[model samples]
Target: MATYDAALVLLVDSSEAVLLQHRDDQGLVSPNQWSLPGGHVELGETPEQAAHRELFRETGLTTSELRALWSGPWPYEAASRIR
Candidate 1:
């Protein structure tokens, strides 16, 4: 079977911005980010579903609408801002 996964979009607005979660260069996998809500896939749940869940779970908000977009890498740096 194909590998499954999940992600989010964090329907942010004026107050909030596309949140970027990354660790410092404290280790090997300690530096990365992206501009959108995201997460991992779960059982009995689509990637979009997982993303929505993650959006609320991580940021604490709801999206009036959610859509499955593209696939790529997280585009963020150490000194970046969303809002």
Candidate 2:
């Protein structure tokens, strides 16, 4: 089993529209797909910190307000089996 920590940010607008980014076709993961702005948590960084960092790095946007919607170890083995 392998464990990886990651974080993602969901940005909503006043019109109730959500923001998403298209991954580069040449990218390593989920190429040419729409995804929320986020990435893996860096060393010595909390998930919240990583979320903020990833949001800024990917979208050039920053916010002081962020709330966790979910946090836990997702059952990777079961998820992989579904795919």
Candidate 3:
């Protein structure tokens, strides 16, 4: 089986509501759907590093603080669904 790595961030407000983005309608997958900020990990980078990079790139937000909650392989079906 093949495998890959990805990173994501869950930003929450004082109200405990999660921060979400409405994907551009022009996005290739799940367009217009609301989701957190994230993307695939790049070579020589850790998931947390990728999460920070993606968060800034996608949302123009940056942070030096991060706490990993978990790590694991993505389901084959879901991974395959993405490009």
Q: Which predicted model would earn the best TM-score?
A: 2
- The residue-level lDDT of candidate 1 at 56 comes to 83
**TM-score for each prediction?**
0.51, 0.81, 0.77
**Residue-wise C-alpha lDDT for candidate 2, range 1-83, written one tens digit per residue:** 54456688999999999999999998655679999987666679888998999999999999999998876543333333322
Looking at model 2, report the run of 10 residues with the lowest lDDT sum: 74-83
What residue runs in model 3 are displaced by over 4 Å at the alpha carbon? 1-3, 75-83
- lDDT per model vs. reference: 0.56, 0.78, 0.78
Write the residue-wise lDDT of candidate 1 on 4-77 in tens digits: 34365746568876566554454222335433545555668777777778778766877768777754334434
- Tell me which residue pairs clash in candidate 1: 5-41, 6-41, 7-39, 7-51, 8-37, 8-38
Q: For candidate 3, lDDT tens digit of each residue in 6-78?
A: 7779998789998898998987545789888887777798889989999999999998787778766544434
**RMSD per prediction, one decimal?**
8.7, 5.0, 2.9
lDDT score, candidate 1: 0.56
Flag regions of model 2 displaced more than 4 Å: 73-83
Backbone steric clashes in candidate 2, count: 0
21: Cα error in model 2, Å: 0.2
lDDT, residue 62, model 2: 94
